[model samples]
Target: ELKVEQNPLFLSMQEGKNYTIYCNYSTTSDRLYWYRQDPGKSLESLFVLLSNGAVKQEGRLMASLDTKARLSTLHITAAVHDLSATYFCAVDQETSGSRLTFGEGTQLTVNP
Candidate 1:
């Protein structure tokens, strides 16, 4: 069974600060993804990590994956109020085609 977990289930961050959300999984996976969601809205894809050491960044959000450890991270740089939202990491099992198991998610509130 594959299980995904994320730390800091709830985060309160001030604007202009940096933070990192950690994601860990129990099983081996080659693909990992990061997503963001706003209140009452669907998730938005932030990054797709396809292999070990794969990294992607956009604006204030950066994501990386390490398949060997079955771990991934989402790093926030200079977080702003607009970046406040819920973040999630999903892992794709090698045997499961297009099936992604999502983490509990980290709800971040960026205050001024």
Candidate 2:
């Protein structure tokens, strides 16, 4: 069984629209995180939620955590071409290095 799950593996958002990505986990343990990958680029760290009600945002991306419910959300406000990429939310397995268990990944495309 997978520890984490994300819906709408592919998200096509408009240039000036708002959308929210969802991340659900099986149990409570390590922290949850959000990351963005641009094309062939590496993962860009967005948010690291250690506990419930932890919210963070930068630019057009906002992320919130709900550790009690085992859920997280990444909200995108007013999408743009530069935001077109893949977003992935992962959860650590409470290990020494805190290895991540990632969702399938959401591919976002912002069309003009």
Most TM-score-accurate candidate: 1
After superposition, candidate 1 runs with Cα above 4 Å error: 94-96
Model 2, CA-based lDDT:
0.89
Report how far residue 79 has shifted in candidate 1, in Å: 0.6
Over 1-112, each residue of candidate 2 has an lDDT whose tens digit, in order, gives 5488998899997899999999999977558889999888999998888878989989999999988888999999998889999999999876577678899999999999
Against the hidden reference, what TM-scores do the models get? Answer: 0.96, 0.93
For candidate 2, report its TM-score.
0.93
Evaluate all candidate structures by whole-model CA lDDT and list the values in order.
Answer: 0.92, 0.89
Candidate 1 Cα lDDT to native: 0.92
User: How many clashes would you count in candidate 1?
Assistant: 0
**Each candidate's clash count:** 0, 0
Q: How far is 74's C-alpha from truth in model 2 (Å)?
A: 0.1
**Candidate 1, residue 44: lDDT:** 94
lDDT of 1 by residue, 1-112 (tens): 8999999899999999999999999998878989899999999988989889998989988898888888899999998999989999998886746899999999999999
